[model samples]
Target: MTHNSIRVHYGKRVVAALFGLAVAWGTPVALAEPVDAANQYLGVWNYDQPDRADATDIATVGQFGINPLTFPQVGTIEFTRGRDGEIIGHTDQGCTWHFRVNGDALDLTSTDQYCFNNVIGSGYNTYSWHVTVRDGREQEVVRANSYLGYGTFDFELTNGKRTRADAAGPGDAARLFTGTWMFDPTNPAYLNNLTSPGYQPKTGAVRIDSNGTGLIARTDDGCTWTLDARGNTAELAPAGQTCARSDGTVTMAFWSMSSDGTHVYTVLNSTDPQLGSYFIGSGSLTRQP
Candidate 1:
C-alpha cells in the first residue's frame, strides 16, 4: 500500500458516506428524484382573491367588503432557493421570508398570506390549512398533487353591478379638442361573469387641452396620456401609466365625437381578465362648463 493510493481511497469513502447519509434524510431525496414536478409550476403562483375565501374570508363577512377588487385582481407569489441554500417565498402583496420544511410542518418565518404579517398581526396572527398524509400512498399523492392543476367550475353570480348609459352631451370637434370632459355617472359599466349582467359605471373626468398642433389629455386619476387626433376622433394612449387593467390589455382607449360633436364616446375593448372572453367597456363623456 502506497501513501498516495491510501489518500485517494480515503477520499472516495468520505464521498460515499455523505451520499448515503443524504439518502437517509428522506424528503430531500424525494424532492430531487423526479426533477420534473419541481421544474413545472416552480415559480409564479397566480392566486387571485376576492373579499371572501376558504377560512381566510370568515373574519371580513359583515364589515362591508368588495369582490373582484378594483385593481390587481391577481396576486403573485414565487418561491426560490437563496444563496445560503434556504428556500424563500415572496408575494406580490408585499411579503417575503424564508421557509423551512420540518417533519410535518412547513414553517414560514415572516410573511403570511391570511393577514398575519402586519404590524399587529391581531385578527389573523394564526390558523389552519393542512393536508393529510394518509396511508402508504402519501408520497405518491404528494408527488402528483403538485401537478394537479386541472378542471373548472360553474361560475355563479350572487350580486353584480355594471353601469351603462346613453345620454346627450356637447363638445367641439375643432381646435384639436379643448375643454373639460366629464364622464357621466349614469354611464353604464357592464360586467358579465358568465352568470349575470351588471351596470355600474366608474365616475371619472378628463381634461383635454390643445398644445401646438397636437391634442393632450389628463385624467383625474393622475395619469398623463398622449392624444393623437385624426379629426373628431383620437387614440388616447398612456405613455407609462397603469390606469387600466393589471394585465395591460386595456392600455389605450378610443374617443370619438357624436356626428354632431355633441358628446364624446369613449370605449375600450379587450380580453376579459377573469375569463378569456371578449370585454368592452364604454363611457359617455359630456363637456362640462
Candidate 2:
C-alpha cells in the first residue's frame, strides 16, 4: 500500500513500530550463555542469505522495474554494552543505525543519508532481511525492511534446524503464555513521557496461542501480536498494522511481562522521525482465565 508518505516530514510521537517476521529461513545456533532482561540481546545475529546457486529473480517487482537478483541484501546486527552503561547497535551493511531495548526486544532504525532514502517510484530499492533463532538457547526473531521506489516489495523465507541431538518435547512458550489474558486497570505498568498525555493504555482481552516455539496473539483490537521469550521474561511487539489513535496518530510500542507471567508492563514510545515530536505512555496488564 502506498503510504501518505511525504518526501521529508515526520509526525509527533503518539505512543510509539516489524515483521510483516514469520517463519525464518533457521540455522543451528550454539547455546549462548544464560540470558536475562539486562543482556538478552548482547550478541551477534546473522541472517541466512541465499547462495547465488539458490538465488531467484523476478520481473516488474514493486514498481522498481525488473532486475536480476539472488537474495535479499542484509548483514549481521550486533549489540554491545558500553562501559558507561549504555547499549550500542551496529550493523555490517554500512548504514548509520541506532537501537533501543524495549523490554527484551531490540529496536533498530537507520535514517541517515546512507541508511534510508526515497525512490519508490523513481526506481524501487529494497533491502529486507529476516531470521529466527530457535532450540539452541535463544529463541528469537530479527526483521528488517526497506522499499525505496514504486509499490512495496515483500520477501519471506522459511527453513529449520535442530541443534539438540533429539527433538525436545515442547518449548517454554507453552508454559509461559497460553489461553486468554486481560488487562488490569490498577497496578498496570506503562511508560508515559512528555508533559501531558495524549493516549490511554490498551484495555480489554488479549488471546495467545503458542506452539512451543513462539507465540501468535491477537488483541481485542484487530492487531496481530508476537512475543519474544527470554529465559525468564518475555517482550511484546506489534505483529502487523497496529491500532491508531482517534486522530489517526500511530504508535510503536514494546510491552514487558513479569517473570511470573502474571503482569505485563506497557510502554508506548511515540516518536516521529521527521516532525521530531514525540510522546510516551505506560500501563499494565494481568493474566485471566
**TM-score, per-candidate, Cα-based:** 0.30, 0.34
Candidate 1: where is the Cα deviation over 4 Å? 1-176, 187-199, 237-250, 253-260, 269-280
What is the clash count for each candidate, in the order shown? 12, 25
lDDT of 2 by residue, 119-169 (tens): 111222223222233333322222223353334443223231112212223
Model 2: what TM-score?
0.34
Top-TM-score candidate index: 2
lDDT of candidate 1 over 1-289, digit per residue (tens): 9999999999999877877888887524333454332222124432211222332111211112333212112223455665543446564334554544434433444333234222111223222222112221111000000111132111122221111111111133344257787766552222211111234344577788766545677777565566544334444443222345454433332222221244554433322334332222333566777
Model 2 misplaced stretches (Cα beyond 4 Å)? 1-170, 186-196, 199-201, 236-256, 269-281
